[model samples]
Target: MDFLHSGLAAIQRHLAFVAVDPIDWKFYVQAFSWTVTLFESYLLLRQYPLYSKTSPPESLARHIGQEDFEKSQKYGKDKAQFALFSKLFSQCIDSAMLQYGFYAWCWKAAGSILGKFGYGGDYEILQSIVFSFTMYLLSSLPTLPLSVYSTFVLEERHGFNKVTPGLFISDLLKGWLIAFVLGAPFLAAFLYIFQWAGDRFVPWLMGFMISFQFIMVILYPTVIQPLFNKLTPLSDGELRSRVEGLAGKLHFPLKHLYEIDGSKRSSHSNAYFFGLPWSKHIVIFDTLMQQSKPEEVEAVLAHELGHWYYLHPTKMMAISQIHIFSILALFPAFLHAPPLLRSFDFPKAVAARPPTIVAFLLFQMILTPMEAFISIGMNAVSRHFEWEADRFACELQDRLKEESMTDMGDRLGRALITLHVKNLSTVWVDWLYSAYHHSHPTLTERLKALESFQAKRAKKE
Candidate 1:
């Protein structure tokens, strides 16, 4: 453990040291970010044998083997497969590169701005807030092209996309409008607050931001989502009643069970519990209701409810606040470094701006390991929560003694496998990959957990 800690520390120190050197900082940051993103993308893409056309079919068979071979075979060698594979690969590459590109752009932009302005105490905080928000806005731009390629080109070719060009453009316009109207004020507030309060005000500001986000979460499904998609109350007869009854039994007060027209854009299916505690609602994609059996739907809903019941969102928020405050506390040390800030040519009064931005970016680069560690911890907890939800579903099954529900679990697993394969997800992900990239445990792992639970139940019987 000590050796591992030391190695991680050394890596962070080396990255920070490189970032502080003016001559190499931009190149190093870009290279580091891009390398990490591309490597992860490669690993994810390698999971789908169809994408690696270089390998002979027999070699691919041998690699994936006999047991798991049936899973890939289910998709078959149709145009759908080709379309899905191309779309998935393209989207993955776009996602990975776009994220890194945004970071690179922001680093350069902030560096340029600060170089002209100079770094100082109050100015440093203002720059951090500005860079953070500006980068977020910039990052959103690439999503337009990505959505078009994924939905119009790839999905349309596969006969999965239902959105017309007009709808797509409208959605984009609405999204951008909302971001500008809602996001700008918050960003402005953050900058002003940081400038006024300095480092001492960071925790309070972060706390307020977290609280604000929580409020948005609560209002999103009820207020915000209606602006884009029609969310009719789920009207699938007995299934709706059963879902309501289940929620009632759990004492989960859910209002407005909605079925969003997710299939209008893509075939992917999902269910989520959104909004604040008081206004929390269960939202199921229309595609999900179309594909999944009632019991499978219940199982998925139970899983989402488990997240709320366990207060996972609140806990996640708390963890994020701690991280933000820690970063804030470290600002002064990096900001005060003359050599690091000198290259930026910031005015003495506002000299903190450039160095502060540099320091923040540099800190983020070095904080990757810490981020990975926290993500691992969170994912582990999430997996446990999933298991707990499965248990809840099983408990309900036992009381009803429903063999139908067992089949529903199997069907749910099959559906997930299909979607994952289409997405080019790593089917045989190792522990390290799961820790960093996958929040939910693998399909096979979840299935195995269910099997184990059933075996224990049978033994008790």
Candidate 2:
């Protein structure tokens, strides 16, 4: 046993020496970053073949014709190819930035520039903010053309884009203005807290973030959304009456039903409710109203109500807080660790500590695997909530119908199918890919679950 233990220790020491002794830290950072990038890209591309191989289940086949099926497959292929190229380009840019010391150089340059203004010396936190802002501005400038091409060429090809160049430019300017208005105060507060609170900075930062998120949620429907799209109240009519009646029946308070001009930006459709309970408002996409029947629209709203019914949003918020606590607790240790800092070429001088924001960025790179795991876990929970919401919609539709147009399950199933077809969603996703990427089950899975529920209910009747 002693011999075996000695041999293992000797092997580990040799391996550590080989890993650390010969290569520059830059090479290790580049190698790890590229490896992760390539691996993720491969994971996404591999799913294309898996998706192509899987035949549609009988439940979905009934709703989608052979012609639509072929189109959907083609759609997936187009997206997969585009995604591969996008990932390659984005990762190459990121890798180049890391390899060429872009971030470190930015920190030095920003510090020097800020020093000219007499506000930079010894204020690592302010320097960090300046560095961060400069990096963000530089990185985003190159992507503007790519964004325009995707919106105009790629999305237009798919018949999804409704944005004109004028609207697009206006939207871009509005976005930047909003980002500055919202982000600057938060950045200042963040740096202030880090400087003022020494050991207690973690909890203070956590509290601030949670408060900011809650504020955003309350502001999203009323303040921010109006900047992007027009929101007009649903006119008094049968559809409005039905929606109001449905909301009343569910005991979910309705502040107002707003029809958003979603078609102004894209052909895709969506509906959502936002704000606190007292301020809850439903916003339905104009495209959805145009495409779906009044009853179908009501059905979609019912699903949204299901999320409220189960308190899924509150539950998710709680989960996020826990995650924040864990991250904040570990972050300081990562920031202070000599080896971690050394790996990133952080200054070795004892008096000159690395910027907190830079350390946080490094921490994120180290936590990539953990982040992926957390994403998978969160998506799994989200998928569960989605199923519950779907079932709630089905049951509510059944209860409300006096004379059934069709089985409530089948009605919702068809609605799902319609949305999927119209959106050109991938019909079948690989299991591993779905585990990481999907927050809701495929249309076929939900349909089957709903059908099974209806069958059991009928047997009881």
Choose the strongest candidate by lDDT: 2
**Among all windows of ten consecutive residues in candidate 2, which has the lowest summed lDDT?**
14-23
Per-residue alpha-carbon lDDT of model 1 for 255-354, expressed as tens digits? Answer: 7798898877777678887766776688888877777667667777866776777777777777777777666555544544443433333344343344
TM-score of each candidate?
0.71, 0.88
lDDT of each: 0.60, 0.76
lDDT of 2: 0.76
Q: Per-residue lDDT for 65 in model 1?
A: 41
In model 2, residue pairs whose N, Cα or C atoms come closer than 3 Å (at least 3 residues apart or on different chains), thus clashing, are none
Error of 1 at 108 (Å): 12
The sequence of per-residue lDDT tens digits that candidate 2 reaches over residues 386-453 is 99888777676456554442355666676677788878788777777788788999777887898887
